[model samples]
Target: MELLEGNESRCQNMFWMNKDVFIRLCDELENIYKVKGSQRISVAEKLGMFLYTLGEGAGNRNVQERFQHFGKTVSRYFSGMLNVVCDMTKEFIKPSDPKFKSIPPEILGDYRYMPHFKDCIGAIDGVHVRATISPSNQVPYIGRKGIPTHNIMAVCNFDMQFTFACAGWEGTAHDTRIFQSAIHNLALKFPKPPNEYPQMKWYLGPYKCQRYHLPEFRRGAQPTGYKEIFNHAHSSIRSVIERTFGV
Candidate 1:
């Protein structure tokens, strides 16, 4: 707590946000989740500790020692805060208006893309987030990387901001399979395409994507012709998702 209050840079580094934003986020969490301050630890302290653990990706035992709290207490506050944040996700993350008028001209003006991606809203991809689970449930979560993880599917617009995110799929699950499930369950409502371009409602992605696919270059051979152009443009646009994940 004292460290968080020390300096702006220290606060940001510890909590992954400025002090003002952290306080505001806590207030928002309290408004919806209602965490009352107890004699042992105040709500602010609990939130701070949880955020520190999350930002640093530290283990429960490490956080327990850092905050001078028991391991169970640290884990409890962390889980509570995580649940509250998950519940509030829908309220905070949402797509822009379906009209598609808000798209910037930069995406529309690039010659490599231009008409090919004029209607593209963004890109979608899957990322693996490490997870810890009981032995009985660990089999399903072990990913191709040979680690227990959850395959998180997310969509981001050209501005590099996430418009949608879904988790809980086993890391062993294929990205296409997870995407198919999301579509079948109607869990995501993608923006509607313009009336004149009804067929352009989908976003661009790599060849492995089920909804969109770029031409594949043959083994030991370079791509040529329109396939090359299309793949280049598609890669340029789809880099947004990579940048978002990196951040």
Candidate 2:
């Protein structure tokens, strides 16, 4: 209760989100998703406990101590909260413009990308997230990172909000493998723009085997030819996904 009623910074430090956002999230979970507070604990406390575990990487015992609940109570609420949040993904993580009718404000306002990248809706990339698995099942999950990880493929808009995410591929799985699976699976509802703009692709990528990253072009030789120039711009726009993951 103290954390919930405390100052903004305290709430953010503990929950990784502002107090108002946390309250709004709880309200959404209750009103929209039909998540109810248990007889002993409120929804806010349940969410706080879950977020605390994620933010601090705390174990069940740590959660029990912090929330002053029994180990079983902590574990139960944590699992419940996780399931509820997962259910919220389809509602929350989707494109602002599903039809891709309007040009993104980021592309429209910036002259560098205005005319060229107006068709680009978002960027896609994969990131490696560490996974916890049994020792017997660890080999398939170990890849170039040399750790048990899941390759999470995500698409983000220019504003850096995730529009779609597909997870569960092992670390050794290729990005193309995950992407193919996502697009092929009708249930995943992978975002595919309308075919009105047949002249250009809905998504763009830098030229393969070319200098693509911004930093490389920055320190070394400047982009010269048309392909290099185009790659630079493509890389610049695509960097939003990298920044989103970085945050």
Candidate 3:
């Protein structure tokens, strides 16, 4: 708590939020989860311990040492906080209206991206997040990068804000397959275009998806003028997803 009040940068690095935001989130968590203080630990300390462990990727033992608590206590609070956060997802993450027409002007005005991508609502991509699973589950979690990971499918709006995320899929699974599963299981939750203009709801994605693809220039052949222009625009527009992931 003293550290959170001390340096702003340190607070951001430790918990990924400013002190005010952290306090607000703590208030929300207490309201929703009814996390009462125990005789040994306060509610604020429990929330801090859990967020520190999550934001810093620190192990339970590390959090125990940092917070001056036993390893079991750190693990208990962290697990409890995780469950509470999961329960609050629907309250925090929500999609825009189906008839929403708030496309970024930067994208709309760009000559390279305007006409072709005017209907695109967002960009969808898969990222590998490292995971540690049991021995029996390790085989399915080995990604193409030869690491144990979860292939997380995400959708980012034009403003680079995450609109949707589907995680916990096996790393060996194809991105398209995970997307299909999301559509099947959570179709109602996904944003849809209005009934009058169904085509307006589209997401830009990699070539593997059933969407537009950039022209491939063969080693020995020159690309046509239209192909060159289209490919350049496609790459430029799709780079937004990469930038979002980098952030």
Best by lDDT: 2
Worst 10 residues of 1 by lDDT: 209-218
lDDT of 1 by residue, 122-190 (tens): 788889999877789999999788989999999887877788787888889998887766655555654
RMSD to the native, candidate 2? 2.6
lDDT of 1: 0.75
Q: What's the TM-score of every candidate structure?
A: 0.80, 0.89, 0.79
The most accurate candidate by TM-score is 2
lDDT of 2: 0.89
Q: How well is each residue in 98-147 modelled by candidate 3, as lDDT tens digits?
A: 46566667688887677777776666788999887878879999978898
Segments of candidate 2 deviating more than 4 angstroms: 196-203
lDDT of each: 0.75, 0.89, 0.72
Residue pairs with backbone overlap in model 1: none
Candidate 3 backbone collisions, by pair: none
- Displacement of residue 139 (Cα, Å) in model 3 is 1.6
